[model samples]
Target chain A: MERLLAVRCPGLIEEDESGGVLRAFDRVVAAVEASCPWVTVVRTGICTLPIRGPARYFGGEHAVVDLVTAAAVEAVEAAAEAVEGGSSVEAVEVGIAEGTFAAVLAARTGTIVEPGGTTAFLAPFPLAVLGERDLADVLARLGITTLGAFAALPERHVLGRFGATGVACHAVATGRSGNLPGLADPGAGRRLHALRHPPPPPDRQPGFWGGASEADARAAQVLTRVQGLLGPDGVLTARLQGGRSPAERARDVPWSARSRAGRSGGTGSQPPWPGAIPPPAPLLVHRDRPAAELVGLDGTAVAVSGRGVLSGEPARLSVAGGPWERIAAWAGPWPTEERWWTRGHRRTARLQVVTAGTARLLVVERGSWQVEATYG
Target chain B: MFDSVAPGRVPGRVPGRTAAPASTTPGGRRDPSALAALDDLARRIRPTAASGTRLLPVHPALAPLLPEPGLRRGSAITVTAAPGLEGTLAVAMALVATASTGGSWCAVVGIADLGAVAVDGIGVDLERLAIVPRPGPHWAEAVAELVDGVDVVVVHPPFAPRPAAARRLVARARERQSVLVIVPGRAGWPEPPDVRLTVESSHWEGIERGAGHLRRRRLLVTGGGRRAAGRMRRCELWLPGEDAGPGVAGVAGVAGVAGVAGVAGVAGTSGASEPA
Candidate 1:
């Protein structure tokens, strides 16, 4: 499918006269990165840049066009948020086309064109898009209502009457004009990923595990493993039950969101039930040290598992105002068993205890206790 | 309260009306008559006339053009200007300054061209001023909506279809009892108005450095339209200080124009002919 996207940064001009426009431009670029990983942002401003590399990388001009359109929309949304006045920014219109001039013209007229159809699309557009005063007036007087009519006029006659502007307009109308020189290429193919997992229960079997006693822990481990496999560019698609059906859900996802999953391997599996697996634990890798210290201040005792924990030491530790305090009382090997279906790495033990000062609950899996969940 | 007309008297002086006292004073004691006269004077002075009118000070240049010396509680005036940055800023500042002094809430609709510095320099109360830029194609309706709440509304004319809409806006101003200043382009409209003042550039001599002072201006003012062809007057106005006090002086041989010179300064030139 061929698609064209136009992104707009509304209120950029009003927000900052000097450097704000450039900042807004950077924000749009960042938003496109976050949303549509496979698409590239072509030319930044009114100018046009080459798209040959992006088209070749995406396997054809059609796919590249679709990817560009999706990324542009995402970028526009991001730009809107980054703007000073928030969403109240003036109306911003975007247009995508096969040719640079055609795309710009479409944006001014609030329309988008299909790939390889620049000539057909330019037919209805007014000649005012050229941004030249003299040529526009002449075009209007020549009984030319649309760009198609202007382009159909004899090239020699047009050039003779209007000079360079007429020649440029005719070239753009025909979609055979070269990309404006000296402009930098916006780059190619964004990194997008999407993944979905099956619901947890009797009906939906775990990846390699079974049963409900330690299902939560098994599910957490499986998700962590999957995240590792996807690498940094990958995005997991978590499909919860309720609302729309799976078929409808696929169509409803925005192009950016669809593209996010493309980075991790194309498409991920869907949940067995509509609302099956419990929501994934928040991705808490690389938690800030200050945040960890503050968490310690809550006076909650947590149990830790894995290689960091030492055996026979009191598994319960209290997190109070400053650092972790090893609690002498309220210690026990709570014993958490996960992934019973899988051998060797199937089961694990976690300890549970409450701190003395705050009486907060903490869980430690295996041999160590780190502040996990705090209870009143 | 003491009664001013009453006086103290000695008891049994007449002796049952048998004989007059051997006092040679003619007309007896005049104390009673004097007290009565005093009482009459007191009663006359007790009640004073109440003043129902109030004085409002405005920019001296705009004073004569307004129906009252300054803007009153209910009056509509239209101010138009050229399209460039200088002209728009000049008109916006003047209107804002006038409204701010009167303690009236002012609103600028569809006037995005005004810069923040220009608005601040004009001393518009930011708390009282509301600027709505690009109010869309329905600018007239938007202005009308603001009319009910604001005391004054200054609207910049749209790129198209402005003249007829301006007349409707004037009517809206009257309906809401709010003053409306329409900033028009170069073309002057034929709309009938209570007062029309045309501002034109003139050579101003003796202006202090960095202070806005106009020593002379061709201010064409025509009052009374349709009902009466009011008097037309052309006057020269000079600014004496930063406080915007007028230093009016009479010019010779100017007809149909009132010449108001500083009475104190013209004491030596009493016989000078006043321009009228």
Candidate 2:
């Protein structure tokens, strides 16, 4: 069976209609992209990705799930802490099952249907879940409220009488999409597009909330005065509780106590950031700059050129005609080749070099060489 | 600038025609109980910052130049130096080392030339450190984002500070309960820092010639701000003081606040004289 994972950010519906919330969500999306690629965004609050390959690569199904969930939470927490009222938006739900619809519903309903059990799991849900008002009303009149009871109807009559949407609802009610073959090939970029017209601007989405509520504004006031009485360092902090959804994980305690809180409760992950945390994370990292081209002592471009060869002994490098520097020591010509199986493949070789006056540089040679970071 | 402004005064407004405080309405009659209740509510609302923060560690040898030996959370502090990059940075790094080791996150912003080797030499935990070399025009917003997540935010704010941005960032820091350590940049903070320390004189002595590298620094650090109008104190010391058996709490009598100020050496130093 095809393996699918659903990710949900609950409580996304309720927060101020503000851009900060969307930016925070964007970080969560970036975090997801860091771990898995085959993702189809369900909506602002939900998304799904094919996880069979990653599950096998990273130990097992449970391990990859845990890794992705922890990473998503950490990123979401960091991004949320950047905005007002964003402190409590951290619980993220993950549900795994057979198809997109069932997996998302499982995430929303907080269910983790076991493998191959999609039928039995989705069978007992209420008819309102179908979200088809007219069809649901017709089914209700026929005394069919439970999905299992509705799915038991004759398929031909349901198709003949109620039409295609009714048949689709029946397919969803019974938890089966007959058209899609259970290919199980994760590398198959079959349905989900790599990118689509950018998601409607976060505010343009339905149910946008912007201004702060009276309660939040009131909380800010209470927090200020209590700190005055107790001293700025005397604030209280909330503990992380295991929640069904991401936002709910940051337990919503009363504001009086929360008012005395410290800078978010620290991302609070045991291992903190894992594989993705760049080594050392240089305390003096410069912002992304235009790629600096590296040239050899002979003055030719120092890269794995068109003929696929390291141009020459690496020596001089310059940033957009700014200045040139000498390379003192070096290592690595590690190659990264990806998606060769698909039409748009990518390949690049990276070099780690130390400059003469003591500066570490990570240079990637992709048709041309560009400096990525400095270490010394 | 914000601290000196009157409570109800809005910028550019005529003094006599200022807006009324939250407790008053158009009728113009002041309600005593309402005013008293407002005060109580105001008192109830001040949020506590870094409730769990303990005293950030300093070298045991230099502890007398501060009004409070312990760094307080939700406070803005300023440190000024006399030009040399290493000397000024040494003082800043020494102060950050203690807080970072204590498990708090610290970030340094806008001082683009800072190097990793220098920070490492000062003994700060690089794991807990974050650096933003160029914040561009949205410098205030960048620092505010970091303020919400980290315990200590050290910034040499970009460009001349504006009152509006300054007030907003300061308020954000207060809400998050984090400390904002402003290293006065090309343009200083729009608002005055709560605690300010200036390096009076910094002398590097260990490097004799081209043969040796810098090892010991004799620093004269003086501190004075809102906390000290008359009691401004000075300290002299080796910035990365030796990690010895115990830090001195000192016998207080000379400056009463000998145990409080942050200039480091009031107990005694090898070269320079210090303030009590």
Chain A structural similarity (TM-score) per candidate?
0.38, 0.45
Per-residue accuracy of model 2 over A1-376 as CA lDDT, tens digit each: 3557777665332222233544565566668867764454444445667677678778777777787788778877887676565434667777787776677556555556788898787677766555455676788899998778988998997899789978887887777751121111121111111121122233342222734333233334533443443344322232233321112222222224223222233422212221121122222333343477777778877666544357677777666676776765555454555455888876656555544332333445456555544432
Query: Which numbered prediction scores highest in TM-score against the true structure?
Result: 2
Model 2 chain B weakest lDDT span, ten residues long: B11-20
Give the runs in model 1 whose Cα sits over 4 Å from its true position. Answer: A1-376, B1-57, B72-74, B80-92, B115-123, B162-164, B187-190, B204-229, B237-276
TM-score (C-alpha, index-matched) for candidate 2: 0.36
What TM value does chain B of candidate 1 have? 0.53
Q: Give stretches of model 2 more than 4 Å off.
A: A1-376, B1-36, B39-63, B83-86, B227-230, B242-276
Residue-level lDDT for A303 in candidate 2:
66
Cα lDDT tens digits, model 1, A1-376, are 1233444333332213222334455555554433332223333222222344455667865565456546545555655655565553434445567654555445445555666777787676555444344665777787875667887888898889978756876776666662322111221101000001111345564323523323233323422332233332221222212211112121111112112211122222222333211111111111111122212224443334454242443433424445554442332333444444668553333233323322222333332334442211
TM-score of each: 0.27, 0.36
